[model samples]
Target: MAQKLQTGTSKTTRYAIWAILILTVLSTVALYASMFLSQDNNYKEAKVQQDNYKKYQEATEEYNKKADKQAKELSAKYYNSFKEFRKTPSAFKASDVKELEKKDLKVGDGEEITDKTTEFYAYYIGWKPDGSVFDGSFNKDELKLPLAVKKNNRGWGVIDGWSEGIQGMKVGGVRELTIPADKAYGSNGSPNQQDSAKSIAPDTPLKFIIMLIPKFEEIPQPNYKDYGF
Candidate 1:
């Protein structure tokens, strides 16, 4: 009877071991399936995000093209209008302008200009080669302001054409300057003006009537070491 009981006990122990082995195998398989599903979901999400980004890039490019096109059209319209205006005899005729003449200018010939300076001045009317008024200083009465030349400012603030054109002009001298766009505002006109007035897109000509005023000296340069600045 004792031997029979021992055999039964061994059989029960073997059955329990088999059951534990089966459970472990099932758990491992379940864990593997979960991991695979998680990775697949992440891959799908990444693909979708990439597709969205591609679409966004394409849209941005299209928008820029459209904007550029519109800007060109607007510029063309303005350029044509300006041309038409020039054709009119009245447009070329201004009562304020006494005469049109050309004068050669030299460097360092004008008044000695320091870093920061101001001058009271008047001018007739200035035009680009296209006969557009680039500087309407003559249209106004008096201009009194400091001309800045430092970084982020209109340093050495002189229009290229005006500076070069009025070299030998005596103080209180008057003259008309017909400047090419290259000498005036170049491809991009002065900032803060209308787009139509810019030199870039339309690249219109420039003209000017300049009057010289008394030149003033600029403030002396500060010694950085003295202020420990």
Candidate 2:
């Protein structure tokens, strides 16, 4: 009877050890499966985000390219119409600009610039008496985008001649201005010292052909948040 009881106790001990080993193996397998699932989910999410960003970048590039092309085409259209006025005024002399003088190149039926504070956009070419172009809105033979002159409550944000000369001119009008030294840069070459390209000699007269155009609408840049950044 004593031998039988000892054998039964040994069998129970063996069964408990096997149960513990089996439970440990199952736990290890479960842990590995959970880790692999988490890693796979993270990788998929990263891939999705990368693909979205690439699509957004491509869309933004295409949008900007179209906008740029449209802008260039518009500029060229207006530029070609007024490029003929780029020639020097007939018998133009710096001495002839004793006072602010103006000659209308083309009259427009659009809204008149009745007030000095009325802001506008224009394409212009300024030249010295020698017919050398000092500054202009042209790039080689092509015209660049129109420049905006912001409104100032005080008056026009330009030379005294422009403020007075632009009066009564309508939108889409072209005007040639012969500005005297007093109404132009005066004794100073330019108000901005860093602007060496536009600088002129003291007491020098200048001429310009101004083409007023409609306001330009700007294209907005793409937002990162819109692309699920």
lDDT of each: 0.49, 0.80
Tens-place lDDT per residue, model 2, 124-162, is: 888877777778877777777676777666666788888
My TM-score estimates for the predictions, one after another, are 0.34, 0.61
In candidate 2, position 227 carries an lDDT of: 81
Q: Which stretches of candidate 2 lie over 4 Å from their true place?
A: 1-70, 89-91, 191-197, 219-229
The predictions' CA RMSDs to the true structure, in order, are 16.2, 8.9
lDDT of model 1, residue 222:
33
The superposed Cα distance between candidate 2 and the true structure at residue 15, in angstroms, equals: 62
Each candidate structure's count of clashing pairs: 22, 0
User: Candidate 2's error at 38, in angstroms?
Assistant: 37
- On residues 79-193, what C-alpha lDDT tens digit does candidate 1 reach at each position? 3322322322123432233333465232223454332334433324445443555434221223223232322355335656665665556544555575565665556756644
Q: How does candidate 1 score on lDDT?
A: 0.49
